[model samples]
Target: MNNSRLISLLGISTLRAAPRDVHLLYLSRFLRTAAFGSTGVILAVFLSGLGHSDVRVGLFMTLTLVGDVFLSLVLTNWADHFGRRRTTILGCSLMITSGLVFAIASNYWILLAAAVLGVISPSGNEIGPFRAVEEGMLACLSANYDMSDIFAWHIVAGTLGVSFGTFSTGWITAIFQKPVGWTEQESYRVIFIVYTIIGIIKLLVALKLSNASEVSRPTVERQQDAEQEEAQPMLQSEETSVAKGPGPTALMRAVRIFVPELTAPTRSILWKLCLLFAIDSFASGMVAFTLLSFYLHSRFQAPMSLLSSLLAIPFIFSAASSLLASPISKRLGLLPTMALTHLPSAILLGFLPLAPTIELACVLLILRAALSTMDQGPRAVFLSQVVRPEERTKVMGVVNTIKTLSQSAGPTVTGSMAQAGNFGAVFVIGGVLKAGYDLALVGLWLSRRALAEHDDIVLPNVNDNLAENEGESDGTSRV
Candidate 1:
């Protein structure tokens, strides 16, 4: 095809390939993340203003993570049975309640209760069940499109939303404090009110999702019929014997109903991925953007407005990196792309505490941000590709839940250390641990690839399924 015609065709194909639900999902992620980003920037500052010490601040953050871990585990594991839209709306409602409590409540115990029982993002990132279910839905909906590109755009949307929220909160607080004659505490409360409004909007958007967003469940009868049809001649007698044996017990049937049955290889890969991810998440908790903001304020006595602008820089770089992730993954492969980009960022984090001036620290932070999140898109795509279709939600839920559990420990320890005047140690510890995770990930990927090659096992290509689906559709040309 000629160059002009080829370019036009590609544009049309891309537009046609994206479903309405995927676009809505992106919009919902942006709105929800904006709320999280804004609250995360101010959560620690607001709590400390309420006369709580640094240890209490850290304890609150840890409890918030524990609540999220529990809720996410239950909601995501049964999302297929309960319906994704319903679970997502329920999560949004919890966020709304959390926001309201933060906006109005002043009692320390009351706020702590709200933090522990309600959905909130103390890490300035996804902390509820929304991500696990949404990722599974996006993977299913984008099966016929460019999976990497779709995943890249999703992260880009979230990063940009977070950037806007972080930057705006600082300015908003400043404005409210000066012209509006509000105290710093009151100004922060206004931000939480905005968070509540955003949650309401997200809830409405989630409600608009179509029935196509529901998870696909396979029935036992259909599985049995397919197995019978595919049985080989030599295996027919064995299959019949098994089928004729006593039916599964009540406990086994319940297990099958709620839990997905993954093949042995898929299960093994899922467990390894979860372990690696938990290590990274635990490190992340030590320097969660929320706690990091608190650290900057307490250690350097930086102003909130300045801190807000500095924090936003990383999200901007992360957004740009997210857009570039698809092409990078295409060139470098998923595992390599994840490892190469992440290692440098972790090394940069190790140097953050050594900067003598705020300006130098901000510069290092921006550079780290540019490289840190480049793995997000590729990692999501890798997980989606490794598991069976029906197992996607379950696997994503399990991984996310375990990661949250691992991360919950970091804040308590870091908080106590910071309270004890060991402010610089957390960054060094987090950076070193993350760097170790990156190295181990690379080793695992190499070993797995070698074993697959040695055994002559062919892995499925993500794009091959898209091409096959296109061919099966009506004879319209595809790019």
Candidate 2:
């Protein structure tokens, strides 16, 4: 089979399938996210065990973000042309390779190499074609599916993956503790095994899809054929109208298609939201690695079992919260919901360190969980409303790359702060930063005046463009 057909064999398609297709895609995403979850919980632990300093760990994660910058810039542009599915498969393969590298590496350089190859700049979150093509493909699949609802479902699956991986990794560590003579650091090697296993499954899923379902014919052929069949006089008139004005060059049109400008009101709102997201991510990143791990070890002297169970709580809450996002968005408006949830979560994160007991900590953690994830779906909806549809992938790519970089930096900063015996400082700083983020959102909502009521808007170019823009089917203009 030719390359395009081979890609379709792997589930990349031009003509969107039914909602059933998304279900399969969602399943793949869930699995992918679950594998990713293990890395989030374990990477800090692993690096610290290797006697790496907080700054070094931070630098290590930064590499991933840096790598993502170059990689995503190129890949997203490529995805606009080649199918998202094909590119996603390639990214997944890289993730698996990274996992194997982590499994064998003992020194800092090896870990750094692994981060470069596997963890740092990876698209574990956004690499999939399913997401890149989501709006277009879903619109093609069924009118019943709401973009908001789909995003909510996506977040739910993500939380589920995170919970499963985090909990499982902790359990795996505890189970192997005695048999493997587990030192705290040594236990981390097991996490790599889990990562590898997840990667392999994702690879298999990608390779098994059919490519014939994805490729479509060129658009020019259809236009030419249509012209040949039209009434002669009418065709001549249409040709005359077309010839009267010069068409835009492909490159100029593509630039406009990919990067859209936000209106004056929307611009300020989006900037504030972006700042909020950045702060929230930064704080979340800062303490994410140190908080749970330290809490479990320091307060309760608990084994892996308890930590695993605690890790599961946020996922449970997030799953529940996602189902309610759409209604909440409808009821409260996207901006309000986004800000409200995040502000409260920031408060909760700040207070988490004050819990006097493990049960209290866990409860606070659960509360934090619900509040933190509640805004995810709404935030996505908020973005879609403000920006042109075609620019979503590029915007998301840029934003995601920044988030990844912040996350990488978070661990190092938090780790260093904690190492200095000011563990509480991490939570305090993170919470304050998150609160600032929430407050900024408030300003965004106030600044924008022409904010429309929550009505559904659909784009027609979504379906045909998915294939055509990807250079898979030549019928449409390139993105």
Candidate 3:
């Protein structure tokens, strides 16, 4: 009886596991991220190595943001219609094939063409469906576990990928014991092979998943109600259970762009968030492109191998920061915690130019990494709180696409300045601008309540209400 009781307890614990999908997603993302981290930070440096000018590198970088923006705006709704699993498989296939094609690209134009084909430019949206599917799956996995902890696990996995990828790149480049024809740049091409292999693994994992395996809210109720709706046909001797294509015409095209309107409260919050994001991102963009690679290259004259190792330091700090984020949020509150972290981050970023020794620069960068990233998890929570559930995917896509655009522009402008011999000034300018953004955020908080209590607001549809003066709502849930 005692042994049976212990077995039962173990089963319960497994059922209430903190992140049920950790194994499901961790390896796939690690593979994708490893290849991505190895190249993106140092792409401009690689381009410089190939004798391309900074402007050309900047344009190459800009193409990534352009793709993200285009895809998010145009294709996001298609995911809503086609089902997220199918969308994810398609997206991942594109991602995997693009990386392999990229390995063989011979020249700058070929590389640019590879980027276009791969959609490797820069896109969270490309990967967004995977998260949607996983999160929906996790909801079915456990009723008792806190969603926050699960998200934390997701972040932990992502950081591991980044740190591991960067570290491996540096290590391999540092000790290429084989007398192969692999140049430092060629090592990046090899990383793509890793990405393709992982993509295939994830594709296999995808096959094991079922659309109906995950339970959504009020699952039985929704199914019953949907069946009821389909039971009766009112017009033209036929009943349509699903919304059909809006039809193919110029008028339909115009209607598609204009029909889905964001609510007023959501619109207001979105604009403020966008303004804040744009300001913060411009600074972040500049830092993102130049910070690690340029500092290592210009100040320390570090090679690709050492550069990879040095890049690991920041991601390591980021992983630590994410681990401690819950306790930090509990102590500081969300917005204040974010502001406090950024103050130091901006200061450290500005101090980069002043570091007299390579050691000092690394120390400052690590410090900046720890503080700057503490906000990421909490910020995601805040986003969920501010938007309705049905609209969450579309809203997130729009906001993330904008953020990507701002980040994409940062590298281009900063690369130009660095090439013009004004790198120091750019750091100072970025820091001050970010500091101003921090101040603006603080002001926004001062005007509002100390903390926002989550509220679920559902609006009644006009047509549905007309059927009965008794109003009905598709339910919404919030904490």
The candidate that achieves the highest lDDT relative to the unseen native structure: 1
> What TM-score goes with each of the models?
0.87, 0.75, 0.78
Q: How many residue pairs clash in each candidate?
A: 0, 14, 1
* Model 3 accuracy (lDDT, Cα): 0.58
- 319-340, model 2: which lDDT tens digit per residue? 7777676667766677678788
For candidate 3, write residues 1-479 as lDDT tens digits. 59755433223333345453445655555555655666555566666768887667767766655555555544444444445556657767866776677666658887776665454633111232344444434333323444344444556566767777677766665555245656766765665566566667767766655554333345434433543454333222323322443323334445444233344556677778778878887777776633447546776787767677777788788777775664565556566666777778888888888887777777888888888766765555455445444344455666666676677777677768877888777788888988888888777665554233233332221111111011122323221
Ranking by lDDT: 1, 2, 3
Clashing pairs in 3: 64-121
Candidate 1, residues 166-193, lDDT tens digits: the string is 9989999999988999999999999999
TM-score of 2: 0.75
Q: Which residue pairs in candidate 1 have backbone atoms (N, alpha carbon, C) closer than 3 angstroms, thus clashing?
A: none
Model 1, position 434: C-alpha lDDT score: 94
All candidates' lDDT scores?
0.80, 0.59, 0.58
